[model samples]
Target: MVAALLPRERLLMGPGPSTVPNRILRALAAPTLGHLDPQYIGYMDETCELMRQVFQTTNQLTFPVSGTGMAGMETILVNLIEPGDEVIVMINGVFGGRMKDNMERCGATVHAVEIPWGQSFTLDQIRQAVADHPQAVMLGIVHAETSTGAFQDLSGIGELLHQQGMLFAVDAVTSMGGHDLQVDAWGIDAIYSGTQKCLSCPPGLSPVSFSPLALEKIESRTTKSRSWYLDVSMLKNYYTGGGGRAYHHTAPINMVYALREALAIVVEEGLQPRFERHREMHQLLRSGLEELGLEYIPDHSLHTLNCVAVPDGVDEAAIRKRLLNEFDIEIGGGLGVFAGKAWRIGLMGESASEKNVLTMLAALKKCLGD
Candidate 1:
């Protein structure tokens, strides 16, 4: 081995992998527990219960799937979409596009309803699509488009889908813990989220929940799920029953430990208070960005994930590099159609503190020399 790695320490206000809390980091070092150990099983059940509180759902099919956020996306598609099923995917940002790709890969016919990047889908458009494709089995969209920081109205879209008898699925990878996401209240059939964004854990696990109707659809599928590991049928049994010890995979023992500690912190702080913290930090950042004469692409739909428009005569990449190298502050560059135009600043979980907000604003100001 060469010299040990010396990574530069920076305020991670990027698209994801948000700054983790010290307590959660310490928990990652606790003695590893066997996957099926009785104590570990108890921890697992407790984690699921806490997730239900965060998700604001009583859906029994909720748990942490042992992979990244994308795993949660694939889990819903593979388990629910049959070969000939129709899926209407509302595409506004990269994550929505990913959902469409995942659905198509599952051999389902994907009807993509496109919206401009940095914008959100409207309920009228969704209802029109559902009417156009009467046989659609599922409708999918990203609740918070991380690439654009545009939050779609999940309640409106979910209600429209529910009225049409279409299963509502959302990629809440960046929204779950930061924003108000009541899965049952919104009538969401299937939802997925990553631990890193707002949960403040490392990015190894995806927390997913399925409504009973969605589970019924999965159960009644005529074709076997394309991916065996992601199939909810057997995994549900393993996670929910028989002592809550199912050997789906290794289960990432240390990562699970980190997530449990992170969720514990969330519960201790309380979800409502945590959401308010994120909202407050977001407002601070927004005000600072406006003071610097920068504007957001989507003015009305600003999320806790703030995307600021890059100013004229600025090299977006070079400025980000200089900020990291000189000030030890990390912010994300734009993606897709918004590339070279914006920066995604995440105010989530532990990173949503006032100190981080002020630090990032000062660093960004210095970078812009303003």
Candidate 2:
């Protein structure tokens, strides 16, 4: 067999998979232990605890699902949504659209409240939607819309959901470790996150949590979940340690080790500091973009995932390709309606540093011939 060779240098600044820290890479290389070993079980328990801390919740159901962001999204939607159930999904970006698709596939009637791309939903709009669909089982929104770089108003919509006595679920794939995600305080019922974003780990696992109300709904389901592997009911026993250490499936042991180390780095940096660092890097990037005469898509809800509107004469795809070929730096193009209109620059995890911001700015300026 030929030896596997790879590029020695590359910077990951894409939407989902941010640059993994060296510490996490080292942890992945640590001696592999038996998946069911007592020490490994203890490590699993510690990971669960760290997830709760990172999620800012006391929910016992907090654990890393053995998949990517979509896995976490599917796990929550498939188990919580039953046939003919009414799920009110707010769509302002691609992720929201994905949520609608998943919810519909779960046999729920998806009632969508949508706004223009690059814009977020207003409380008034959501209030109207809620009034229109009073029988909706859950209110789902994307906390950080990675596609549009729009941060939706969790406080306003969250209050309305609470008043309507509906479950609140958020797709926090891009916001979990970067922003101040208050799952319990915001009254969120079910939340999902990916390890590849602000977590600074590889993309194999998805950290997920369910509020007591959500867990209760899952437990009280009349029919078995459509997804057997993703059913939280069965998976909980495996993570929380029941008799015989029931093997649901083989866990991604090395990925979990990397994730645990990633979580440790988050704790060391502290969540507030981490959020501030992202904000600072974003500010630097935004300033540089503004200096280059580029404008941001979203207004007040501007996320660290800066989505800059491409100039009229710029070849968006060509520029991205040039950056990849010449600088070995990867940024993202737009999605959905914003395709070819904007560029996505991620400031997540270790990639959320001032040096990276400056490097990206210089590279982009060169790519633009500015």
Name the top lDDT candidate.
2
Q: Give each model's whole-structure lDDT.
A: 0.87, 0.89
In candidate 1, stretches whose alpha carbon ends up further than 4 angstroms from where it belongs are 242-246
Model 2 superposed RMSD (Cα)? 1.4
Q: Which digits, one per residue and each the tens of the lDDT, describe model 2 over residues 1-370?
A: 9888875566888786888878899999888888888899888889889999999999988989989999999999998999999989999899999999999999999999888877887788888999999999898999899999998868766678878888899999999899999888888999999999999898999999999999999999998999988988888888877556688887888888999999988988998998888888888888899999999998644445888899998889999998899998989999888899889989899999888888999999998984
How far out, in Å, is residue 226 in model 1?
0.9
Q: Where does model 2 exceed 4 Å of error?
A: none
RMSD list, candidates in order: 1.5, 1.4
Query: Which digits, one per residue and each the tens of the lDDT, describe model 1 over residues 133-218?
Result: 98898998888988889988776777778777899998899988888898988999999999999998989999999999998998
- Candidate 1: lDDT over CA atoms? 0.87
